[model samples]
Target: MSKISTDPTRRALNGPTMGTRWTALFHVDPAIDTDPVRAALQAAVDEVDAQMSTWKPDSDLMRLNAAPVGVWQTVPMPLLEVLVLGRDIGLASGGAFDMELGDAVAAWGFGSDTADPVQIRAAMGRHRNTAALEIDVAGARVRKTADVALDLNGIAKGYGVDRLADTLVALDLPAGLVGIDGEMRAMGLRPDAAPWSVAVEAPDPARRSPHSVLALHNAAVATSGDYRHWIDVQGCRLSHTMDPARRAPLVAPPASVTVIARTCAEADAWATALMVLGAEAGATLARQIGLDALFLLRDPTMGFRSKAVGRLFCDQCPEAAAQHAQ
Candidate 1:
């Protein structure tokens, strides 16, 4: 059912989780209490975190990761969906966007643990696992062929956003936008039928500004960037984004990669993949996959430059696009 608005009053519900927050903006009847609805939305994302979080030791994903190799582990449907999607995207990106990098991420201090060279070396063992992950979607089960670790941190937030959208839609929210972190999904037009305006943040972490504003409707957008999250390694700054081949944070990761997809999960995964692939190769992959993406590149001579491909992204803000062009 399309959630078209029947009333004009707008209501927003939000709560904190995943070190961030999940929010829903929608049209509601004046009498609707929205307390129950808010709780349901929070529960939705909480379930996702319980099923997929790498930070939580008791999470379903951690349990599965701790299980013996080749042993089939039953998991929730949402987890199964994420594993399958992550596997597909990893394969499509030629292992550029690996989901099984828990040890490396932890070793690099991106996770809770401090950086350890031994763990990093062990995690980056050659001829052992370039990538080894398997899933049985039909059975809602998973089995690893190698000793590598699993982490869905890259895509879980976007999946959380999708879950928020699903909850609002299930609750019959009449036309609104939902988001978790930077991943966002717009459900429908406003009361005036004007599309919801979503700003694409400029990739500069030092100075935040809008690169462009998108008129989003029933679509999701996600960005992966190197600017915001980083750590200094011996005077060299490294992003939280891990490169599987290097077994370390991207040395000079792209400034940002934004993707608009039918679902937030895809957008999240692809944005990360593109950031790993850089501007040129990422643009090629985005084109081949027929996805709408914008790659923000950092040039030593030119500063920040961006390229957009597949589907219209800046149809709402020509002025911002023009400014970016210059």
Candidate 2:
């Protein structure tokens, strides 16, 4: 907690979306219409779910998935943006964060149904290449050169966070802070002119604890970890973030990966992508792409250790990271 807190009349709102809840911490004046604000916030995220959710059979993403190969299907602007960014990161990460994992995701039981052994057996990794997905940004259209199903599971929640932030901004509360599940975006300072404090969740599956706290201003963060959203297969635990090559949860994955960027969607996708890249390769790619990332890994003998490589983590959380390392 900061020395200063937001206003006494500051309203808090939250509701369900994408199997998780969205939150807003904002201060509104008597002149503001809160009912409309709430509706808008809810609508923004619902629109995203309608467009991107793999669970929804009629979602815009599923429709695109059902489209014939090589056809340039028209997509909404938001979906277009996420698809473009997903592919860009996919290419940059060498398919480590591949967006074309819809089949694999559904096969792993992360989608609308239980895992199918048959689909799991058929799931295969994509050949990394930027040329595989063709996007007409100006026209808001997309085409796939290969038979890859587009899945935005890695990035949609973060985009939802960004949407919440966007709704707040639209209501003229440019300084409000928002969280969707654990993904967060700080629009600006609080009403008291204090930076919003966000907690970085510990990688321990058995406990809900803050590994560290972040002072966020005009930034967004998303964390992808093996701790949550996992299922036990045979005897071992597996994260929902599957490995394309093996058609299973990422093998020997990092405990967690946190990424900060200007947009929550970018943070979301990059976090998943970097997790897939593992600590070494992911860190290198983050540095190359000028992204801020903190990687938490288990040291064989030393236990939990964090390796942070990015301008944001290095600058804002230097002291916190140091204390955690100790």
What local distance difference test score does each model get? 0.83, 0.83
Tell me model 1's lDDT, rounded to 2 decimals.
Answer: 0.83
Q: Please list the residue runs of candidate 1 whose C-alpha ends up more than 4 Å from where it truly belongs after superposition.
A: 1-7, 126-131, 313-326
Residue 9, model 1, lDDT: 70
Candidate 1, residue 192: how far the Cα is off, in Å: 1.0
Candidate 2 deviant stretches above 4 angstroms: 1-8, 125-131, 300-302, 315-326
Instruction: Please write out the lDDT profile of model 1 over residues 1-326, one tens digit for every residue.
Output: 33444455788889987888888888777668899899999999999999988889999989988999988899999999998899889899998889878888998888878888888787777443754767777887888888767889889999999999888888888478889887898887787877787788888878889887877877888999998888887898899998888778887777888888889999999899998988788888888888778877787887877777775634233333421110
Lowest summed lDDT across 10 adjacent residues in model 1 is found at 317-326
Clash pairs detected, candidate 2? none
Q: Which of the numbered candidates is closest to the native, going by highest TM-score? A: 1
- Model 1: pairs clashing at backbone N, Cα or C within 3 Å: none
